[model samples]
Target chain A: MSATVYIPREATALSLGAQSVARALAEEAARRQDAVQIVRTGSRGLFWLEPMLEVATSAARVAYGPVQAADVAGLFEAGFLTGGKHRLNLGPVESIPYLKNQERLTCGRLGVIDPVNLDDYRAHGGYAGLTNALAMEPAAIVKAVTDSGLRGRGGAAFPTGIKWKTVHDAPGAKKYIVCNADEGDSGTFSDRLLMEGDPFCLIEGMTIAGLAVGATSGYVYLRCEYPHAQDTMTQAIATAYAAGYLGADVLGSGRAFELQLRMGAGAYICGEETSLLESLEGRRGQIRFKPPLPALKGLFGCPTVVNNVISFASVPIILERGAQFYKDYGMGRSRGSLPIQLAGNIARGGLVERAFGVTLRELLYDYGGGTRSGRPIRAVQVGGPLGAYWPESKFDTPVDYEAFAGGGGMLGHGGIVVFDDTVDMAAQARYAMEFCAIESCGKCTPCRIGSTRGVEVIDRLVAGDRTAMQQTLLRDLCDTMLNGSLCALGGLTPYPVLSALDYFPEDFSTPAALQAAKR
Target chain B: MSERKRVTIPIRVEPGTDLPAAERTAVLEAVNQNRALEGSLLPILHAIQDRLGWIPPRTLPLIAYELNLTRAEVHGVVTFYHYFRQHPPGKQVIYLCRAEACQAVGAVSLEAHAKRALGIDFHGTSGDGRYTLEPVYCLGNCASGPSLMIDRELYGRMTPERFDDLIAADAAGATSAAATSAGATRA
Candidate 1:
């Protein structure tokens, strides 16, 4: 009998040499005439242990990893095919502390099943939510989502149920469900992970949204950067259509729900809901003024339920288990598990899914195991580029939306990028302004002009010219961009700048001090 | 830097210069495949770029004419997007991640090393027309910092040595193709 060996085909794992490892395994098996079958699955989110190969034993799946192609010959020589002893062997993947400790509601099936196989997905409890949602009334479905306390996982923290109910009640003959898969935020890959690892969950979630609202059509506005994800999703969509999970009638319910995938051409602003809608309509991605919410007037001038990829992907679980069962996991107003991506300069950087109350200190030290460079951790940036640079002092803040917001930070896409003591806060601040300047949709002046000026001001400060005055001017410029901008692109650029100035004033002042001392 | 502010600076095309017959026919076919869909402009632009190497200056008018849109509108979109190349690209394109996550773990140094090695800045093609360097905001491989992409294949945890090897391999492939073509010419 042939034993099945699991190798991750996800982008991150592939980048870290999973493809070469898979090839080596195949070649070695053929050379030895060994009966071994290789199956490509998604990463278990333990990125540091990538090329993490698994062998299915009668009892459990044995694991080995951070494996390279060069190590394959040695692994085979050590009789690793039937889970023999090797230096890389991590017995029974479920026993690994990094993955075992956390709650994985949304990502339960990630890295577990073959992403494109319909039967594998169903066996692991994939469409149970859609099945349950199919039996309920639209209002009941909306009420269930609301009762579960699910909010937009895309940083906004807006209640998902309320958004659905608005679209459900809105008087529109045609409505649309648009999944915001344009995850342009740096250090964030939960959306990409979900889309690539288990695309059926996203499809099921969107279908539930389509049924909840009267929307007959859905679109996933995915960014072009994710070519692998695009291929995976496209294949998954085709599979769903073949299985009658999509197209003219979903699960033979006699209701039509059509889904299409559209690619965005390298625009960061399009991650915003309105801008995404504009890009979907085949126009430049520029932020539109709010007041007429997308739930009221959206894509093609119809009510639209524009939710993030994670938000939609989280829906299946809410329906599969009752709302109360899911809601019981989280703290405060923030309900359910938040998939936090630990990235950049961290020892064990990967996806960590836990209930909302997990502290930054716990996530950084416990799960992350400090900086990869082994340097003293100085600061961490929660969220993306637009999020604040949190000093060590603020590490106690919980992962909840309100807790983060109260501490002058955001849980934007729940991406945390750690920086060691070697980091220069001033340069990071300058980068924040520079990023805003580059990606700003030219529609708003404060974002357009203010960001450019902010870059110049930071440059002047860095060059040791009139530091005190520039610091004050930088704050004022941030205020203007904060209050006058149309969207978060302009409004949130100040978070990093102001936080840098406030948290690490010494770095900004050192240049001036050095200049004065030299004089 | 001053040139960056302009939304649409019209490309200078010599008078009476048209796209080659085969390329023109391919563009028309690509446009026809998507013209019936609502908001077909972006997809049409993508198709043209896919069919041809890049969106030619002469083809914008052709696209506008077929899609019932103005030439200015088509020009605006091509310029607005960073992905759409204004000119034909080299044999391979490399997109380096320049976002904050990458920078946190040595992307800045990688960018400098890549620029020095390639002998071209961002958006510049190599002198031998073998490579084009571009900057992408993020590639969603932030867990492994200092990520880059050649064509569509992503590479991460890159060092200067590894980068040099990758470029060398690509150059070797280009040389072999050139050699084959030269042999074909002799035959």
Candidate 2:
């Protein structure tokens, strides 16, 4: 057997030239007569180190990167195959603080094994949750998830168990598990990371959800933006079916669950649950009125359990490790780990899955190592485009759901995009409204007309109009949007807009105000 | 279990489909293949778009006819989503990320540079039909932004200089670039 080398096939890695690096490694090894086995695995989510490569030695897998095609010759000369010293060599893979410090309960399988390899997945405790769930009653499975206190990782922070119980108790012989993989958030990529890196985990998670809610059919509503993930997940689903982990009888347990992958065309409203169900039924991606919550009537009017990718992926661990074990990791009502995607201008951006109490300060400074531009960090946007902009004053805020909501910021998918002093908060506020206008489903008046008006008002404010008047009008518009819109697209757009106006008032001043201050 | 039978949606050239023979056949095939699947309209539209570059105007009524849906129903879905293009697109479509993460990293300047270099505005195709520029919210490459995708290929940490080079390389049919390696290696 030859020495084994691991390289990432994750979209981020490919974007940063891992495919070229893969070809380079193969070409270089052949030229040097050094036979080696190269395997393309999922990313470890330490994106700053990608296309981060690892070599399996006698003791452990030694790490070296960020590798490029040009460095292939030097790496071979340095005896990288034998774990030789090189400037790019970061030593062992596990010693890196980003990976070491993470509470990787849900993201543990990422980059550790071939994502499509069922045998490798099984070896790494993949099916233990399913194996355990197969024997238990459906209610018991629901009780375990409820007891674990896992809330929706999709930003709403709704308890997963209660949602499952609603569908379970709803009197229907036909129920469906719909995984919301329509991750359209600007700064969030945790769902894309899991679907591309640890795909089988999502497969297992959704399968378990089917059993819990008595649903025999499942569909993953993936956004068309993530073509790489679509390919990987489609392949992984096929592998599971062949292995009897999916379709008619899962793992030969005498239970039936069929899974399919459905693609969503570009529509941000589809990320909203009611809108998501409408899109799944082949209609215009419109929002439905919400008296009959999706738990009761969803996805073709069948009782459906709709979960975010991370919410479902977190289930296997709770079932395998027991509710108490999973519950013990976090603070307050938030149990288990949240896969926080540290993105944007941060120095060491990647996925950091920590328990609920982790602070934004720790993630920004300690893990992220501050801005990549080496400038004074000005603002951070937690969640996606809809999340509020946290000024430097709020950096110490913890990652708990209630803590964020208390601060007028919801932990809607944990993604924090950092910006330096060069950022224009007023401009960002304009964009928040602009994005809403562009993606609105046109189902309501407030979101549709108000967003376009919000942009016009902000433009007037930015163009040195009556400052106090414009501010009041903008606030009034945001109020209408928050209270009047049917879904979060219109509802949550106010968070970023109002937060900018409130916290960064200096950035909102008119030219007259600035000149008056100078005088 | 039986091999699932496909649902056949018969084509009606009601108001007359003015498409070329090859194009019409491909559209018919896509709709017929996906007819039996649940919520198959989106899939059918995707298939037609994938094969013909855009959803041609003539194919809509035929599609509506086959799916047992009205032209209004099919047209509503096609126009609702940003991904579907009504007219034929250029050889390459560039989805430039204009969202906050990309904006934080100088995407505003990058967007300006792209517009100037391509001689086209957002959603505009070049005179030569070489490229079409589209403003996208995010390409899921936020950490390495400014991000953009040329067709299905993703490019990250884009600068004006690198942008020109990538366009040149892509024009030459090269699949890779010098990849401004996401800034220097991990510290």
Candidate 3:
């Protein structure tokens, strides 16, 4: 019998040299004349410990990592094939504290199954949701999602059920279900993680969405940066089509549903629903005015259900295990688990999928193990580039949508980027305006002109030129952008700038304070 | 920050450069593959860029003619997208993450190092046309900060030293490949 070895093929692990490790293991095994099978799986989200290797033992899968190609020969010498003891051995993979603590409802099979193999996906209870959804009526399916209390994980936190209901109820012969896989936010890779780790899960979720919304055609508007995910999804889509999971008469249920993959060309604004729709139509990715929301008229002037990758991916679990089951997990209106990506300067940075109400301190300290630099963590930016910078005093805030909002923060896409004491809050504030300036779709005056002005004001403030007046001007500019922009791209850019100015005033006041003291 | 500079540069058509008959056929084939689909402009442009290294000015008319759209309409999309280059790229394209997440972990200095080492700034190709450096917002490898992508392969936890090694290795590979092709020509 051949020994089965698991190595992650996801982008993060691949970036860390997982391919060379796989090759080294294969070469070592062949040199020893031993038969071993290497299965490329998705990352388990323990990024600090990747190129993580797992050897299937009789009792369980033994883990070893932060492994490199150079360590493969040493691993073989240590008899790691039969779960032999080594310096890098991490015991059972499941027992890793970083991974074991999380509630992985949406990310349960992330690193467990072969990404491209359909049979492996099925063996792990993959299609149960679609199978269960197939027997039920479309309205019932919508009700199931609604009752789950799931909201948009793409930062808006709008009720997912309500959005689906609108598309389901909207009178249209040709409604479209567009999966927003254009994850443009920095420090947010949960969407990319899920798409690369379990491509079929996203496919199944989109299929279930198609069935529920009575839509025949679905498109995944993926970003061009995720080449690995794009390839994985393209392959998975073909496999789903071949296996009767995607085409017309899906699973012999006589329901027609087709899925296609479309790549976005380097436009951050395209993550906006209207901009995404326009980009899909092969036009400039500029934001369109709302009132006739995307639900009513979208994608070639048809009613459409545009959802984030995580939002659609969370549907299968809702349908598989009743709505009450998913709703039982989270607190308040924020139901189910949030896949929080812990990134930037953290010791044990990875994906932490926990239910809402988990405090920021718990994620920052317990899960992340503090900053990688061993210095005091000055600020942690929850959400993405547009998210607010939370000071140490505000770290006690729970990871709920309303709770974060109340504390002048947002749980946008659950991406938390930690910064140590060496961070410059003033630079971060300036960057917020600059990022908005770069990515704004130019349709709105406040976002387009205001952001560039915001950058100038911040520069003046940072450079000690009229510091007091510039601070007030910066706030006024933020308000204008917050109220006057068309989409979140322009609207939310103020969060980071204002929060940085509010939390770390010392960073911004240094040059001014020095000048004042000199006087 | 200067009231958003909107400079509309005229598209430069290099005179005396005609699309090869075979390349023209390939462009038409690409157009034909996607012309039947709704909103085929982006896909058609991507297909042409994929077959040919970049979207040549000559191919735009062929694509416009095939898709029944005006040349300006096609040109607008090509220019709107940052990924679509008007000229051919170098042998390798290095997309360095310039976003805040990467900036938190020495990406600024790393960017400086990359520019100095490559002797090129963002969107500039090296004199030998061996490498082109481009700025990317993020590569979704934020957990491992200071990430970069060379063509399709992503590299993380990058430092100035590691970046230099990568460039040297790529240059060596290019040199060897050139040697092999030159030897074949001599034979």
Report the number of the highest-DockQ candidate. Answer: 2
**Runs in model 3 lying further than 4 Å from the true structure:** A510-513, A516-519, B1-18, B174-187
Top model by lDDT, which number?
2
lDDT of all predictions, in order shown?
0.88, 0.89, 0.88
Q: Name the lDDT of candidate 3.
A: 0.88
RMSD for all candidates, in order, please.
Answer: 6.3, 6.5, 6.5
List the pairs of residues colliding in candidate 2: A155-A412
Model 2 DockQ class? acceptable
Worst 10-residue stretch by lDDT in candidate 2 chain A? A510-519
lDDT order, best first, reads 2, 1, 3
Is 1 or 2 the stronger prediction by DockQ? 2
lDDT of 1 by residue, A1-519 (tens): 588999987888888888778878999999988899898887888999987999998878889998998999998898787888999999999889999999999998888889988899999999999999999999999999999999999989899999999999999899999999999999999999898889999999999999999898999999989987887898899999999999988989988789988888898999999999988887888878887999999998899999999999999989998899889988899999999999889999999999999999999999999988899889999989899999998999999999999999999899999888989999899999999998998999999999999999998877767777888899999999999999999999999999998999888867565685477
Clashing pairs in 1: none
In the range B40-99, model 1's lDDT, one tens digit per residue, is: 777878877776768887777777777777889889888877888888888888999998
lDDT of each residue in B1-187, candidate 3, tens digit only: 5698789997644321367886687787887898777788888878877777688877887777677778888788788777888888898888999887788788889999999998999999999998888898888999997999876778889999988878777766753321211012111
Question: Measured against the native two-chain assembly using Cα atoms, what DockQ does each of the candidate structures obtain, in the order listed?
Answer: 0.32, 0.33, 0.32
Candidate 3 residue pairs that clash? none
The fnat of each candidate, in order, is 0.60, 0.60, 0.59
**Tens digits of lDDT, candidate 2, B154-180:** 778889999998888877877334433
